[model samples]
Target: MAQTTDLDLVHVIKRFGSHTAVNDVSFSVAPGEFFSILGPSGCGKTTLMRMIAGFEDPTSGDIRIRGKSMIGVPANKRPVNMVFQSLALFPMMSVGENVAYGLTSRGVSRAEAEERAGRMLERVGLKGFGNRRVTALSGGQRQRVAIARCLVLEPTLVLLDEPLGALDLKLREHMKIELKQLQATFNTTFAYITHDQSEALVMSDRIAVMNQGRFEQVGSPRELYHHPATPFVASFVGETNKWQGEAAGAAPDGTVAIRLPSGTMVKGQGRVADRATLAFVRPEAIALAQDSSSLGGLPNRFEGRVSAVLFDGANSSLLIDAAGFDEPVRAVLPQAGPLAGIQVGAPIHVGWTVEAMKVFAA
Candidate 1:
């Protein structure tokens, strides 16, 4: 027998007066999968999440949870729960009370609710924390409390809308792994929406990259990073240096060339020909050397001076003002390599293979 999906949206469209918030969006999340909708702010990711949470209704199409239509079903009646950015925990309530609120409201009985809430608190690494005030916990602790509150309901799907947006950088990083672990522990479907690409890349089983109220691409992290289907997906999913140019047709080896405004020619793999095009090259893909000899006759080699050095430990990089490119090209700096200590204003050679580039029509 075919297994039913945990959540599914079919050709869903949502509009507010003249503006279409979500346009013909469709996708499905398998049982226990951690799926994320990734996009920039106002790209309609939040609107889509709201629709799934029953806060907003789609103008067209259907939303299904565990094989049943959710049309006209109120938020409270749906077999789903949402954890918002603010968490919205009651300030006056104790941690236990906040977690047991939904159960008590449903008449689960005070003793049963407390027992369930206590077990859930321990499951989230907060044993003996139920009697503590919600205001006394740290940011990460509060985040887990919020998640535990929702997970205790054992809903079919859990919708998270930028739940970590309020945390500091260090805590947010810690919480990402924790959230993934918690989701796995429960094996419940998670439909997360986030504007931060790093969050989606780190935590999602599959990501749907949305833009301008439509899905740009949907694939695994590796597939999206190595084989982007659209320009928006390429630029939005990761850090890439973008260059505008004109397509110079394909080479005999099936690689397409792009002619930059500086009259420099570069080759990459793409189908765009004889039109305005954009080329993308990742910082780590470019090989940097003191001289071109180290690059061994690479097809795309440029001599330039280091315009700046950005240091982030293992993620350090150098900005090169390469010849023939309008903006500086960034190259990764290995922490233990010979070029690791290279300084600004140093002459450098940067090169890459045609395989490292991605070209698309503008």
Candidate 2:
């Protein structure tokens, strides 16, 4: 027998006046899967999430949780719990009280609620912290409390709306792993929404890249990064050097040749278009060498001068003023290699294989 789906949206659409907030969005989450909807602000991710939570009505289509339709369900009556960016924990309540709030309000006895809440807190690494006021906890601790509160209700689905957005950079990074771990520990279905690509890439089992009120693509992070279905997915999900060019034609081996405005010809993989096309190369895929001979005879090679070096510890990159390109090319700089000592204004040769480049119709 087929397993029941955890959460499903079928042809979901929402509009305020003529502006479509969510347009024919449809997908499903499997049981215990960590699924994320990722996009920039105002792309309608929040509106889609609101419709799923029953705070807003869809203009058309259906939403289901565990095979039951939620078309006319109210938020409080639905089997869904949400953790918002604000967390919404009561300022006056202790950690345990906050976790137990839903249970007590739903007629669970105070003793049973406290016991359940305490168990949930301990499961979330907040053992023995039940009596502390929420304000006294650190940002990360408070986040755990918020998650514990939602999970204690044993809802069929938990929806998180950029829950880590309020934390500092370091804490946000930490929480991504922590949240993923908690989901695995509980085997709970999580529907996470975020604008941060890193958060979605690091934590989600599967991700749907949303853009302009629709999902551009849906797949695993590696599939979205290494094999993007749309030009928007290629550009938005990661950093890459892009060029507007004209398609010269296709090779026998299925590679497309693109002629840039500067007269430099490059080859890549993609559907061949008749005229306008876009090419993209990841920074890490470009190899830097002191001279052309060291490039091992790559299909595409360019000589350029280092314009600037952006140092972000292990994620450092060098900006190169390559000949025949309007914008500077970015190449990753290894931390302990001979190229690391190369200074600004130094001449360098950059090379990448034809397969490393991705081309798409404009």
Candidate 3:
């Protein structure tokens, strides 16, 4: 049996006068899946979400929810709820009243609405704080209340538009875990939109990397991180050291050789029709050897001096100025290795295998 889709966008496009915000976008979300549209501001993810919520009509294509087309449906009639970055919680109402407002407005009895709201509050880890004022709650608590309010109505799909953007960094990190747990516990389909790569990589079951009104790539977190399909994805999705070069030729093993402007030759596994190309290697992919002799015939080798030591506890990195390279290359240092004590101006040998480098047309 085929699994039912929770939300589907078929060739969806949104335009404002002459500028296109969303360009022929198409994708589907599975039931109970946490799908995220990740991109920088002005990428049209918000416009697409509005189309899904019926706040804005698509210039073309269909928006479907649970196999039903929602072409002309009003926002209030749709079986979806959106949680905004500001949360949009009512300040005048108590937490309980705020949560039960939707149900009571739909003619649900006050007693029953309050009862369901209480249960929902408990489900979201706030059991006895229903009568408290919204202002009395912490940022994360208020965020949970906002989510609880939406979940109380048991909507078919929940749209979160950067709901954690207002929280402090520590709280945002904490809520990422909490939000994922809440979605799993309720088994609700969550269509989250955010520009934060760490948030998407940490919580999303699948992520669509949007750019310039289109999806650059769509895949799991691991897949996008390890095997980016586009140069934008490679640069945007994570930290990498990029080298601009020209394609020399393909080796016998099918790896494309690239000749950098510095006249250094490097090999990577990819097809590039354009002679002008770019190569990216993750900071962690390059390992530092204490001496050149320790490289032991690595496919790629470069001698460099440490220009800076970026110490961030376990995530420390070293900035190296390699000979013949115009820009400094960054390489992450192991938590407790010989390279951990590497200082500025220290000579280090950097080495990485050919397969670790990703080549793309410039």
- How well is each residue in 301-360 modelled by candidate 1, as lDDT tens digits? 999999999998888888999999999998888687688889999999999999889989
Tell me which residue pairs clash in candidate 1: none
lDDT, residue 351, model 2 = 92
lDDT for 113 in candidate 3 is: 100
Better of 1 and 2 by lDDT: 2
In candidate 1 the C-alpha lDDT for residue 175 amounts to 95
lDDT, candidate 2, 1-362, per-residue tens:
76679999999999999999999999999999999999999999999999999999999999999989999999999999999999999999999999999999999999999999999999999999999999999999999999999999999999999999999999999999999999999999999999999999999999999999999999999999888888899999988999999999887776998899989988898886458998999999999899899987799999999999898988889999999899999999878878987789999999999889998999
The local distance difference test score of model 1 is 0.93
Q: Against the true structure, what is every candidate's RMSD?
A: 1.2, 1.0, 1.1
Predicted structure 2: lDDT: 0.94
Instruction: Report the alpha-carbon TM-score of model 2 versus the true structure.
Output: 0.98
- Candidate 3 lDDT score at position 349: 90
- All candidates in order of TM-score, best leading: 2, 3, 1
**Distance from true position, residue 115, model 1, in Å?**
0.8
Model 3 clash pairs are none
- Model 2 segments more than 4 A misplaced: none
* 1-362: candidate 3 lDDT, tens digit per residue: 76599899999999999999999999999999999999999999999999999999999999999998999999999999999999999999999999999999989999999999999999999999899999999999999999999999999999999999999999999999999999999999999999999999999999999998999999999999999999999999989999999999986665999999989988887888899999999999997898988887778888999999999887889999998788998999777778778789999999888889999999
